[model samples]
Target: MSEMFQTYERQYQELVSGLKQGCVAAGALNEDQRRPKVPELKTALDEGDSLIRRMDLEARGLQPPQKTAFLGKLKNYKAELTNLKREVKMMSMGAGAREQLLEGGQFTTSQEQRVQLAAATDRMYQTGDRIREGKKVLVETEELGVSILQDLHRQREVLQHSKNTLHGVDDNIARGKVIIHNISRRITRNKYIMAGLIIFLLLAILVIATGKRHQG
Candidate 1:
């Protein structure tokens, strides 16, 4: 069980690290490169989703709270990926359409293109917001993990103390048994000595009485 738990933990950590790295890479891109980076972001998100599902299925024995939190994280990651994909596709289509509308050297206003552009821009901003929120979530999760570790440590200490106390009690009980046995043996020996002394005294009294009779 411990081995399985360790394996699960290692996979979880690796997945989280990959996600954080992907986010950092996304955040570091310049404006000109963001659209191109969308493909990479989607790939990362897809991999995350795949891993999450596998973990969910394999680690079905997870406690309810952990499973709930895991599912929540997966949902957030999946949603962000979908939003980014939509934004990228919209922007790309708008760009292509605008080029085609640049007919006869007159590239003027197109309402549909404008609408798509606006929507794309909104989604872009939303994605940025989500990225920041993801960072916050990661930080909070790390703190929570630390707290859990501390609690485990405290519980281990308590168990160790209890074990020591039990050992001491066992040792004391053994000593008490030995002492009682010795006391019982001594009492038995004293009984035998006491009987012998009484017998000797009776013999002496009888001998004295017989001597007195002879003298009379």
Candidate 2:
């Protein structure tokens, strides 16, 4: 929660507490004594109403999920304010009418039970909000894990392709080495054959020259 929202909430709680105290005090007093306190209770009620409106405005400014989380609290506050207003109205009533409505303390007990129920409901809503937040985090983490796996798969495919390309280059290099070795052997054999033919031609020429000399 924002600091401003916290401040508003604190003020609202104070108003609620003050209103409850005023109602209880007024209940104990006689008609004349309660008359003066009625205006004070009404003023606190108005302030509480205004604070709730402001708190609601703040809630509306929140993101949808957070706003939803705050709705239950806001609703509880409104209900409490309504109850306070009813109490103030009763205080403003004549003694006879007030006694008839509040006879046997049943109404006060019921009101206290409603307040407790509202508090419990607020706690339940908060718990639900926390659960939703945890679920959202888990979902994001799962998506991240999936994305990492996909990236690793792509990298593995690239590495495999590169390995294949290297193997093809190695095969071509091996073939080229064999062809060079064969060409070198063929050139050496042709040189030996040429040398033998030159030697035979010279020997034949010498023999013919000696025979000519003998005939002369």
Candidate 3:
């Protein structure tokens, strides 16, 4: 029973850590940053959940799983996971809000909303230029339309790459700060230890000198 409990706790912690990473990845995606590791994160989350479930079954004869500490934590983790899943959904939505203009009643993330606006602009431009010329306009516009869509897609790709680079820089800066902080802490501790050692050495010398004088 104790061993099963230990396994459940370890699985639970792993799940929590994975969820945190997923949540960060989701947030980074919200910034239109590409997250290529989302699939692996999903796998980790699934594996963690499965491990907990397996442990639950294993402890059936030895203990009551429901009343165990693991269940309580698992429930909390589920709630956190629910919120994280919503964040992930919103990240994909890209544009989300109340808009009567949407033929489909749904919210989209801000990025999708921008893309929708761009599409609307394209449609409007095509409608206005339709009467200017016949075949030339049709051919020119067709090529131009394809070109515009391609450019937009390419621009988004570039922006996502830039965002990812920026995120990397930010993470590096954060890690640097932690490293500096840890170094400072260690230096301070070393200073205190050295001072204590020096004081002890001085006291020992004084004690030996006093003993010699008393002997004299």
Q: TM-score: which candidate is best?
A: 2
How many clashing pairs in candidate 2? 0
TM-score of each: 0.45, 0.48, 0.38
TM-score of 3: 0.38
In candidate 3, stretches whose alpha carbon ends up further than 4 angstroms from where it belongs are 1-133
Q: Note the Cα lDDT for every prediction shown.
A: 0.63, 0.77, 0.63
- lDDT, candidate 1, residue 170? 100
Q: After superposition, how far is residue 213 of candidate 2 from its true place, in Å?
A: 3.5
Residue-level lDDT of model 2, residues 1-216, one tens digit each, is: 445566888999998998898899899998657766776677677678667766776686678887887767889999999998898887665546445555656666766665465456446645654765575566557656866787799999999999999999999999999999999999999999999999988999889998999999
Over the stretch 89-171, how does candidate 1's per-residue lDDT look in tens digits? Answer: 54334455445655546534675566566567658856865875676567557656866787799999999999999999999
User: lDDT: which candidate is best?
Assistant: 2
Root-mean-square deviation of every model: 11.7, 17.3, 28.1
TM-score of 2: 0.48
Q: Residue 118 of model 3: what lDDT?
A: 47
